[model samples]
Target chain A: MSQNNLTSVVVGNRASISKPRLGLARKRAIIRFLFILPTLIFLAAMFVFPIIYNMIMSLENYTTISIATGNAPFVGLQNYIQLFQMPLMSQATWNTLEFVIGSILFQVIIGMAMALFFKRDFPFSTFLRTLILLPWLLPLIVTGTIFKWIFDQSHGVLNYILMQLHIIHAPIGWLISPNMALISVIITNIWVGIPFDMVLFHSGLQQIPDELYEASSLDGANRWQQFIHVTIPLLRPVLAIVLMLALIYTLKVFDIIQVMTGGGPANTSQILSTWSYTLSFQDMSFGQGAAVGNIMIVISLFFSYFYLRFTKES
Target chain B: MPRQGLRRSHLTIIGALIVCVMLFPVYWTVTSSLETNTQIFATHPYLITPQFDWQTYRIALQTQLPHLVSSLIIATGTTVLCVLVATPAAYAISHLQFKKVTWLIVALLISQMIPSVSLDNALFIIFNKIGLLNNYFGLMLTDCTFSIPFNILILRAFMQSIPKDILEAAYVDGAGDLRTFIQIILPVSKSVLITAGLFAFLFAWGDFLFSVTMITQNSFQPITVSIYGYISQYSQSWNQMMASAVLASIPAAVLLILSQRYITAGMTSGSVKG
Candidate 1:
């Protein structure tokens, strides 16, 4: 009878001790929630709210009403359909495509060349590598303005230099000409993009084993053979990442074109980003601007999905 | 044997030529910034050295770059706030076993994919409605929209490599989650925090689209829009323009120099194969 009573007393004591420990664990969980509260609040106000607001704006004929009023008539898909009919819209889309393809191709080609050149570990290589980042390091506003001065028709530095060299009989109106304006923009983009690609590719190149190249050469491989067989395969994943990021950066380029031409000589150089800005602010077609922006979002989402998918597969 | 030597010399010469061509645009900008307007108009523009005038630097220094202070304040505030807010959030994502975490990450990724241009029009309207237009707090909040997702992604990767037993041991020692995070996780992850801070700083500092769209007044504008004001469709202020451009590059250049190691390390984190 005494042993049974002692056992009951010990069991009662154990239950009381465990209760407070469970309470402590619950308290810790609640504290963790509080820690994350500020970030959640920030996202709700800035990101989540704005996204919901944009979707609502896309469905209305907000052209006639002041945005401050926020009482525009709903028009369903009218803004989106009308967006496809605008000539500048089509031209802007085309320009964006050309910009992406052209910029990516040249940037990759030239960047690869620089990567190969800088990979030699020669004297002044580190200085040369750092110096090459100057174009990218400078503000885009500065780069665009410098190029603007360089491309000036009469009494500008570019024309003056060309004439001094006797390279051409007369000056070229680089910005005013529609055909040349986009390419001029591409030249600047290429210059800015080369540094990023060089850095990424150089990192990729450094990871490649010298032993592989030595073995290839010993097996009667040429310079081109080593690059094709050994280098390309090793750098494939890095190349994919570099190209995807470069594409995203190029797609959103606005400040340079805005500063250089104001999308001028008849809006020839306008990409989707600048076009959307002009529509909303300059043209006061808020709904149409929202529509254009939606389209850009769709394109970005599509490309990002593909990139994510590709990354997962590889 | 002679042919091989010739080929090697040919490659070196070709490489040198490409480097010069690659460097010409940037070289031209710095050199031109030194030249006077009269010299710039000269038929044979000097590429190397005819004269050096530090007048542009002086003008850039004295021109009352009104937006620089606002930019510095906003960028610095965003960096500090983001590091404080994101460090714990990233730790939770990496270490904790919460149910809704993956969905949160996916949502963040989707938010990032949606371009800033898409949100600009709506945000302009929203800010105008709330009377938050031209407010630094409003702009900083918007920047965090991009910065948080990227910071979370980068930090999670950095944190994943850290062993979990350290935190588990801390938990067994009667310490709570908060104490473990403060003492164990943060000290070890300082480099990654600096890396994320650099990215956030540069993005907020150099952004043109959000600043121009959200902030309407000239005085409220960042250096980007202010610099654009110096250029017009017809007339241009070459001297003041270059001055503004030079001034605008300073914050970003300073950012790059201070965090050069972190930038290189951050780029190689996922890009290069181990």
Candidate 2:
């Protein structure tokens, strides 16, 4: 949307052509700069400054005691070294990988399915499509909390339904079990994510011309073949964006997992974000938490570079 | 025609089932909110409320009203701040030329990738030093880190589409940049502005990271943090917890239904995400 060529047709010219006087135009330019100055300053204070601060904190021996005593002595790489050697950091690293991958793969697949299903001309499909987006709109905290209820060991709706269906003979503690905690959060994330992916994919699906499908069908192509050859190929642009964003956001999964499991059952489910919080607030190891946070940022920046590349390409 | 009608029913059934499965949590939330704690915890918890009880909600309101009000203030503050800062920046980016607009855009995009943990990790120190801890204004300021750029991008996308002729017309009438923006540009871009504002509000309202990290004081916390505390503190209080969840969802559900087109527009805009 920002790259619309038509958007620049006037303004880039108006700044020069509209004003004849150089001094007056210069004055106008100053005023225009003033408009955006606040945002620039705010972003700097909020993100840029804090990001730099995080780097500094990661190197220093900042902690709860540091806040009180104001004696955060500079420690070169001890925080990083100690955190690396800790068992929690290793577990969090693997868990973060699983959480990100598990979420994006499932959500995109399920979301595309939902999107394709809704694209059909069916009774109340439009209404139901909107209804399906409720999870995405609700707060992550709300989603995680209620899901914690639904995934409860004995009283959970999930276990109850599975047991009733004879799929499981006994109740499973979704959040209590360390391995299941990761799986449970992934499942909840997929539910929250499906609507977003579906919405994006649904729009992408809408843009595919009907003639292509009809032509394929006429060329002796089955529905499945048409989907594989035409639909998947054409939806590449949306797919790229959806995948990039899902990866970026899933990497930052904190509130949901924090509320759902708090990386519980002996720290089995701790991801980098939750681990960072645990280190800083729970453990009072602010320096280690900052180090973990820097690691997360590095991971995000790595993906964001690709995201920017893809956005630029398309 | 009858065959087509039959096919539609089959599709409708599928669609309805999907809706039920996807929305079961929301439905269960409302139902569970209206049931007693005993009924909610019992084996084979009533799928539907046997009695439309208001006791839990009454209790929830007693505890959560202040938290809700606090959340409202913070979210509102964030939205207002976001729009105020973003509109001009978006306008400048779209209408005014900078030395390196692409650089600025890239910078903003990269800023989005800075995880909340890093920001909170540092902001805790900064806020603590500056005496902003447990402060409403501090939380609002932190939440703006999210909404500002999101609104800027969304608004810039819309503002860029506003025809040059409109601004040219305002200029021909001898109106200045500020006047033209206030008189011509703003009224024309009202819907997008509203969309931007709505999503900003939702972002701040749904915020848990900043809420939990910044404001630890019990008297001044949002529903998200409060509900999180409730879940662990009173693990058996499913009825009250669900009631609070329902309360937390009221705004999203209301906005989802009432502003369907705006919600759809905002969703596609990639305003808020994972």
> Which whole-number lDDT from 0 to 100 does residue B157 have in model 1?
76
TM-score of each: 0.89, 0.96
Candidate 2 global CA lDDT score: 0.87
Q: Model 1, stretches more than 4 Å misplaced?
A: A1-20, A34-36, B1-20, B270-274
Per-prediction fnat: 0.52, 0.76
lDDT of 2 by residue, A29-143 (tens): 7898899889889988998889898898999999778999877999999999998888877788998989889999999999999998899987788899998888998999999
lDDT for position B64 in model 1: 37
Identify the CAPRI category of the predicted complex in candidate 1: acceptable
| Docking model 2 quality class | medium
Name the lDDT of candidate 1: 0.76
- In model 1 chain B, the worst 10-residue window by lDDT is B1-10
Model 1, total clashes? 0
Model 1 clash pairs?
none
Error of 1 at B272 (Å): 7.2
